[model samples]
Target: MIDKAKLSALAHAVIDTEIEAVKALHERINDDFMQACEFMLHCQGRVVVIGMGKSGHIGSKLAATLASTGTPAFFVHPGEASHGDLGMITDKDVVLALSNSGETSEILTILPLIKRLGIPFIAMTGRPESTLATCATAHIDVSVANEACPLGLAPTSSTTAALVMGDALAVALLETRGFTVEDFARSHPGGLLGRRLLLRVSDIMHTGDAIPTIDEEALISQALIEMSNKGLGMTAVVDDQYHILGVFTDGDLRRVLSQEINIHTEKLSAFMTRECKTGRADMLAAEALELMQRYKINALLIENEHQQLCGAINMHDLLRAGVV
Candidate 1:
């Protein structure tokens, strides 16, 4: 069997090599990088990224990062492009090609057409003197001193350098475009931050007949039925005007059990927690979650400016809405 020490040493060496490769990308962020950004920013169309094999994998991830961060971009396989996918490219789009050797036949096949369209071409290659690099409107050198693979065959450290350089390009463009959290949220509506920022109490709270509410004078038995039927673990106690007065929860019931109170005779007002914490209809669900967590409570009544209970939301509601 291979010795453990040799395996550990190899792993550490690979990591150290890739780290240095990524760090070297910082030095190449110069005039050519700025020109590539200008091309994409002024294109008025999507940034089309193309590559092959390992380079394709890196290009795919970079394309997604660029799209989500405010730049519109997508990945098209170089081989597929030669087989008709090249039609996806348009005169309005800026093409960014990736090839470690700068001589990938599939990319070269389409290079002339890319130039014929008179669109901007950005190349990321390890060989600065390569045809792809020389033909590019702006060339980004992602050359590495050595591969992380001991055989120097696998595109390890070289691919890492390209990946980091792509990220640098995307971030520089994102900052220049003034991208904001809200802008990112809009693009990722199903993500946690998006839901936390976009969803409000009014959107997910139980309203009308769905709200678990009882009159302040209602018997504890009636409140228990409301809580059980609504399954919110609590019932809001409101006056005749529907103005919230307090809330009786499962905890309150457990506390009253010690006093041996009569459910049929005792009123909710006698056991309810008065002036309970409340939230506004316009409050973000994330904010409601904070309120619940801060007070160690599980439910909250949503009200308007007049303090009238308009809706009810529980921890389960936030969970169902993916805000938890």
Candidate 2:
């Protein structure tokens, strides 16, 4: 059986080594890094990332990060590129080749075609003097002083440094392009972020007869009936023209009961909150959530451009729509 204490020490040491490897990458983000970003930013087509072995795994993640953030990119195996997949790349595209030793045979095999097509090339490698680094438009040095593996045969620290460098490049490009949260949402429409930014108050609000509303002259007992019928825990008190005058909630009933006021005799307008939060139909549901949080309220009355009550929304609605 393995000794638990020894296993724990080895795990901690591996984490510490990788952390230092990533931290060391900060100083290496220099002119070559800038040139690489510039080439990718100006490219008319996609950024094609090519790699082999363990470098391929890191390159796949780098491509995904770039695609999600604002840069258009995809991963291509260097072996496949040499076996007729090279047609997928175009002269307008930029090639980002990864080979920790800077001497992967498969990557070197495609250098001539990449050069012939006049496609801009960026190489990430550990050896600056290797052929892959020497023939590229720019070279990013991802050299680590030592591998985390005790045997020095497994890729550990070197791969971590390269992945961190890729992240830095993607983030720098994201900022330079002025990419906004809305832009990110567009790229990820099936995510919760998209639901929060894209869903509007009108899209989730209850309209017309579905809205829980009572006449301002109606008794507190009648407002309770409307709230129960709609199952929204609250009811809007509206004027004869259907313009909202106030909102009456279950909490209002509790306060009225404390005063011994007759629910049967007191009108909704007598105890309802006159100054209530209102929202516009075009407003984002996420914005409505913020307003609700700030005011410590759960419900909002929606008004159209003419200041007429058009709909209503509560925290439950936002919750069901995945906006909260």
Candidate 3:
């Protein structure tokens, strides 16, 4: 049986080693890092990320992060590149190659073709003196003093350092390009974050026949009928020009009932909320949701510059639109 005490000690050592590896990277982010970002930012073509073995797995994720964050990039396996995949590389593109030892034979084989294409290259390696580093325009040193593996054969601490460096590069490029949340949403439209940022009130608001509405002079009973028919628990009261004058909600009905106001004798204008919170048709559904939460209210009348009621939305609309 294995000794549990030894196993736990080894685990702690691995965590301690990786922590130091990442800490060392903080000091290495200087001129070369900026130069690498400048190279990719100025590239007219896609950034090609190439790596061998385990590094290739990390490289693929790095490429994806860069592409999704506004930098046009994709991963190219170095072995595949040596066998005609090199055609994908162009003079306008920038190559980001990864090799912890800076001596992966498969990656080295494609160095000549990358050079022949005249594409700029950034090298991420442990050894700055290695051939790959010597050929690169910018070298990002991702060296760890030692592998976390007891046998020193597994790629543990080294891989972690490389992945962190890749993240740093992607974030730096994202900031330098002034990439906004909207830009990120454009890339991730099918995801939840994208839906929250891209879906606007206009897309989910109920308009025309679907909107519960009544004239200002309408009786409270008539407004209640409109609210029940539309199933929004509220009705917007409009003026002669269809401009919003007030809003009548279930909450208001409850208040009126407590006061024993004669529902049959009153007009909606007498009981409706006159300074009701409203939203613009073009506002983001997420923003509308925030307003609703802040005001402790749900329904909102959508209006234009003329204050004309164009539509209406509620907390339900935000949920349905995936903005909640």
Candidate 4:
């Protein structure tokens, strides 16, 4: 039977080897790296990435990262490119080819066509003196000293090195393009970051009759009825023009009840908290949550551009919308 300690040691060795491989990539970010970035940055069309096997998987991830971070890019298999998928590339685009050995026949097969089209080619290979590196417009070396695999055959450390290098290139280009979180969010609209950045108060607030509201002249009992009906635990006190005068919340009601105030006879204007925090219809839900947390309040009255009360939101609304 195999020793359990040996298995654990082997796992640790693999992790340590991969970590060192990634660290070695830091020194390889030379002029070639900058030249590659310049080529992609100036490309009028999309970046077409091509690779084979494990390199293809890494290339696919690299393409996605580039596309999401302000650089538009996509992956095409090297094998596919050899057939008819080469047509997907254009003169205006830049080609990024990946091959650890630097002589992937499928990638080499398309090199002549790329040269004829006068399109810029950026090659990422483990061999700096390889044919692909020599023929390309720019070359990024992702050579690794050894493989984490004990047999020295399976792509372990070398693939990890290439992946880290790809990430480094993507992030470098992202910084050069001055890409922001908002820009990244636009490309990932279905994600949580997109929801936090793009979701506005108008998108999710309780509008129309859903807003719990009462006139300033309404009795505390009437305000309670509106709050109960709206299920917001709070009611907005507004004037004839729907201008928010204050907010009456369950906390305020409790304070009033502690003073022996009669709900049927006390007007909301007399018991409501005059200094109410308000939000705008155009504000982000994340900003609204910050406002709620800062004031230790559960509800916020939303106003339109004209400064008129238009909507309202409570903690529960934000929570239900997954904005909290």
Candidate 5:
């Protein structure tokens, strides 16, 4: 086996080099960077990203980030652009090309066509005077002094710099366009972030007949039956017109049993926890989860503007909705 100390040292050195590469990017965020953002910002169509080799991989991710944040974008392989995908680009679109060496033949092959179309071209390359940079409308330098790879052959530090630059562009455009969390959630409706930001208490809560509820005058045994039937492990002790008064849970049942209280006849009000927490229907399920965690409660009743119980939710509901 290789020496453990040598391996550890190598890992730390790689991390240090990558960190420095990212740090060097701060100074390069200058006029050219803003010019690139302006071109993308003013474009009426999508931002078309093209690259070759390892730069191609980073370009794909950059396009994804730009699309998800606010700017419309997609990655077109330079090789494919030559075959037929050049049609994917339009006169209204802006092109962002990536080339660490600024000399990829495939990307260079399409540079003339892009120039002929008269669409704005932005280049992210290591060399300032390279043909690709000199041909572009704006050139954002992503040069790193060293690669994180000790061999200096792999695209580690350079790729990191490109990724960071892409994120910088995405975020700058996102803020300038007034993109909100709701807008972001619309783009990622299937992810956990979407659920946390968009899922509301009303969307998942049990409403109407599904709510486990009992009267304030109900016996302890009646609350247990309601909890069992609804399968929420708790019952809201509500009054006429469905206004919540208290809550009876399995924990209250344990107390009743330990005290040798008569479940068959004892009023649940005497044992139920009064002033139980409630949630608003419009509140985010994530917020409700926060309320539950803060108050150390498992189940919450949803109340409407009238302050009457309308629906019920539990930890299980949040978990099932992927908001836990």
Candidate 6:
């Protein structure tokens, strides 16, 4: 039977070793690392990453990170490169090749061709003086003292070291290019961050005849009827020209009841809350959420540059739009 406790202990040991490996990576970021960043930044074309096996897997992830963070990059398999994918690499582009031992056969097989093309190449390797490092325009040392594997053969600590080094390279280049979160969002427009940054109020607002509204001179009973009909829990009190004068909410109705005001005989303008929060139709939906949070309000009226009631958005609408 398997010794579950021993297996758990071994797994913990491996995690500790990998953690130490990443911790030791700070010392390796020297002049060569800076040179790698500088070379990539100056390249006029995209970053083409190539590797084999486990290194290729890591390279794919690094390529994705680079592309999402503002660097145009993609991964090409080393074996595929030999079979005509090398055409994807251009003299203007930079090639980032990963090989822990610096002698991955599949990667090294095409070195002569890269040299012939005169494309700038960077190598990540455990050995400083390996063939791959020697051929690179800039070499990043991802040397691990030992493997986390008990047999010292599996790619463990070494792979972690290489991955962290790749992240360092991407982030260094990201700062050099001044990559912003908005730029990052453009690359990941399908996630929550994309929705928060890209979604605007006009895209998800109740406008036109659907907006629940009543004139300031309207009776409270009529405003309540409008709120009930629209199901927005509130109604905007506007003037004849549709300028928002105030807002009446279910909470206001409760407060009026507590004050013993005759709900059937009151005007909405007399009891409505003045200085209601408003947003622009073109503003980001995320900004509307922030305004709602800051003012502790549940609903907001949308206005134009002239402060006319163009539309309205409530917390539920924001929730439906993924703004929450």
Please provide, for model 6 over 208-278, each residue's C-alpha lDDT reduced to its tens digit, 9 standing for 90 to 100: 98899888878888988999999888999888899998899999988888999877888888889988989
Q: How close is candidate 3 to the true structure, as a TM-score?
A: 0.88
The number of clashing residue pairs in each candidate reads 0, 0, 0, 0, 0, 0
lDDT of 4 by residue, 129-226 (tens): 99999998999999988899999999999889989998998998999999999998888887889889998988889899999888988999999999
Tens-place lDDT digits, model 2, residues 31-148: 9999999999998999999999999999999999999999999999989988899999998999999999999999999899999999889999988899999998999999988899
How many clashes in candidate 2?
0
Mind giving the per-residue lDDT tens digits that candidate 1 earns over 1-324? 879999999999999999989888878988999899999888788999999999999999999999999999999998898889989999999999999999999999999999998999999999999999999999999999999999999999999898999999899989999999989999999999999988999999999999898998899999999999999999999889999889999999999889999999998888999969999999899999999999999999998898899999999999999998
TM-score of each: 0.95, 0.86, 0.88, 0.92, 0.87, 0.89
Supply the global lDDT for candidate 5: 0.93
- Each model's C-alpha lDDT? 0.93, 0.92, 0.92, 0.91, 0.93, 0.90
Which model is ahead, 1 or 2, in terms of TM-score? 1
Q: How much is the lDDT of residue 235 in candidate 5?
A: 94
Supply candidate 5's per-residue lDDT for 22: 93
In candidate 5, how many Å is residue 252 off?
A: 2.2
- In candidate 6, stretches whose alpha carbon ends up further than 4 angstroms from where it belongs are 1-9, 256-266
Better of 3 and 4 by TM-score: 4
Error of 5 at 242 (Å): 2.1
Residues 1-324, model 3: lDDT tens digits: 999999999899999999999999998898999899899999999999999888999999999999999999999999988889999999999999999989999989989888888888899998989999988999999999989998988999999999999999999889989999989999998889998889888999998999898998888888888999999989998887988888999999998889888888898887899999999999988888888999999898999999899999988878877777
Alpha carbon lDDT of residue 220, candidate 3?
A: 86
> What lDDT score is found at residue 207 in candidate 4?
94
lDDT of model 5, residue 95 = 98
What stretches of model 2 exceed 4 Å from their correct place? 1-5, 23-27, 82-85, 188-198, 219-221, 255-266
Query: RMSD per prediction, one decimal?
Result: 1.6, 2.8, 2.6, 2.1, 2.7, 2.5
